[model samples]
Target: MKKQITFSIFITMLLLTACQERTTQQIIKLTNPSDFDRVDEPIVLARNIFTIKDIPNKNCIVLDKDQRAIPFQLDDLDEDGQWDEMFLLVDLKKKEQIDIIVMWTDQMSNKQFRQRANVRFANKAGDKILNDVNRLRSTDTKLSQAEFQMEGPAWENDVVAFRNYFDARNGIDIYGKRTKEMILHKVGINGQNYHQLDDWGMDILKVGTSLGAGAIAISSGDTLYRVDLPETSTYHLLVNGPLRSVFDLKHHNFKIGDHQLNINHRISIWGGAACYKSSVTIDGLQGNDALVTGIVNLHSDTYIEEKADQYLILATHDIQAEDQAALGMALLAKSKDVIDVSEAPKEGSGIVSTYLLKLKAENNKPTNFYFYAGWATQDKGYTDKSYFMKRLKKDAMRWSRPIIIK
Candidate 1:
């Protein structure tokens, strides 16, 4: 009886231990490791309820499909208060693109947390990531500015391409040297220069250039872009993908033929197609009142003139509170100077239509100004030309020039 009783106690203890071990296993959780096939799985992260998958042959982990939101803590790596939820491991699969959805709890009172992000996948095949890097480098000129110290296969292309890659990857746009003309070389299949064909683009194309200005052009495919370097530097960015859309930090992109001065960063100049042939003159300071002065000459082969006509100018200085009211009025009243409008003279003779502007002063220091001149007809809007004539008269009005009647 004693032996049987002892054996029964031992058996009960063993069962109890086994039950406790199973309970412990249930409580422990494992983080899902990223792997090849399911690199972009819909991540349902919340407080609880998630499963993991292991691909030993491939050596990866994948999250099982769970639409249910599981709570997870956001690890603020940057410490800026913005939380980073989860990072997905991506690999080339499907079209090398995968869409992922993150069901997160929203901090708002709505009591919901749901979000989604599309993470792209790269091929395990031939230098997939490296090739992407090269594609971006081919268009950016700034990347070439860096003196590459790391040794490797000498990059055959220009440094702009490499710089573009770095900037694009870092969410910045790299600009190349800005010039009025760009020359493109086309090589034939036989490794000979194909300069004979006119459409082949072996010849240089002349694009208009504005003074102290910059511009950006996006390709039709939206896969690549060309950014004119800041006036401060002679560079341009031929950027691939989305990095081509960033704006220049220094110069403003002007769209109108005329503008005004203000502490505001962006100023719009408005006019019509008549502004095209119109000559423009900008008079502004370089450091004090206005950091820049520019004109947006709209040139087009078609007469549609339907595109938005506006000039965007940026100001560098901050204006005082008292000055803000007057400045705002000046901007609205087109108090900023522009060139005068005049008719083109008979073909041969040099009948120059001159426009003049005066520099007014506030504290004995001359205030900045500008002038613009152009030729356009009544059909294109701006028939009266009253504004142009009035501004010209005001600018050239005779001041205190003392003279004796002879």
Candidate 2:
């Protein structure tokens, strides 16, 4: 009787233990699997209270030159119940904690938020969010400039993981400088020093030797070319003047010695004016004089300046044949039939001649409009007389439709 009772009890206990183990496995499988601890993996002590003590006095943190931070949006980041990664945004203008973005590991996680600390920035002028790694690395060496350490996952924290994430997000590896496509902050080399380039020429680069970006420059006899770089990257190098001709003035692919630097540019003009109607006081009507003034209507004025054999080519494009003829006749005091006789392209996509028209004012009265129109070089000359006539004509047609600036 004793043996039977003991055996029965043992069997029941074993069955219950088995049931409990199965239940635990089901819960683990259902709740979340990524949180499972792998063999020999070190457990991360989750960060509970993350705080930024100090922020820079400056109103902005310029990345390269552009400001990246807007008002922080906490809701923008996804979050989970258990502690995960988060972002702390410090608004420099308000001089307070702007937002906390809780990033989550799972799909259905909720985030929490808190207000700014009672301790403000006035007494904490030099105090800033110190970076742990930077402090450790530069323990003996003092920084030349005020170094506010930025704390977060470094770019190379997990090279494989980061590469995956970065490639997923931006779809390119900018640091590597290759892939299907890319975007880079470019600086051109001139001799020993590297200068930042604008559309027209070189400017002081933001990343000099001081920033560890290295000294980049265009050397003597070395023409700055962008072709050696990738297919669709932005070049910070500009084409400086006093030239052996503007080779790739506004072109993408061209050769410059051993290297080929592709060119992309943003072209703009200023201080030019326009006259809408035809009248006397029109300069450079026929004579070889460099400066010419012309009135479109009885009142509107336009000026032209000659550069070498070519008048400064202002704006040139294509327009409709009929409309252009009407405008040419109206502006030039020529017959509409004569205007129609002008050799323009077919009814569609005909070229319209344009010039740089400048208008300035002294006090309140409207000053005269100065303008220019002609070819740049004989090699770069207009293919037809009609192209020049359209611009030269004072009554050149302008569409009444609204031109959208932006």
Which numbered prediction scores highest in lDDT against the true structure? 1
Report the lDDT tens digits of candidate 2 across residue range 1-406: 5754654464334335434422110100011112221111111112333232221111111111121221211211113433232122221221121222221111221112222111111111223321111111222112311231111111110000001000001110001111111111121212211122233112111111110011011111412211122323221211111110000112222233444333322111111111111111211112111111111211112222222111222222222121121111111222211111111112222111112122111222212221222221211233354555544542122111111111
| Ten contiguous residues minimizing lDDT sum, candidate 1 | 323-332
Residue-level lDDT of model 1, residues 50-130, one tens digit each, is 222221111111221322213222323233554333322222232233222222111111222222210111222212222
Give the TM-score comparing model 2 with the true structure, all chains together: 0.15
Best by TM-score: 1
Query: What is candidate 1's CA lDDT for residue 267?
Result: 11
Query: Model 1 residue 133 lDDT?
Result: 24
Error of model 2, residue 227, in angstroms: 47
Q: Output the lDDT of residue 241, model 2.
A: 13
Residue 16 in candidate 2, Cα distance off native in Å: 51
What's the count of clashing pairs in each model shown?
Answer: 41, 35
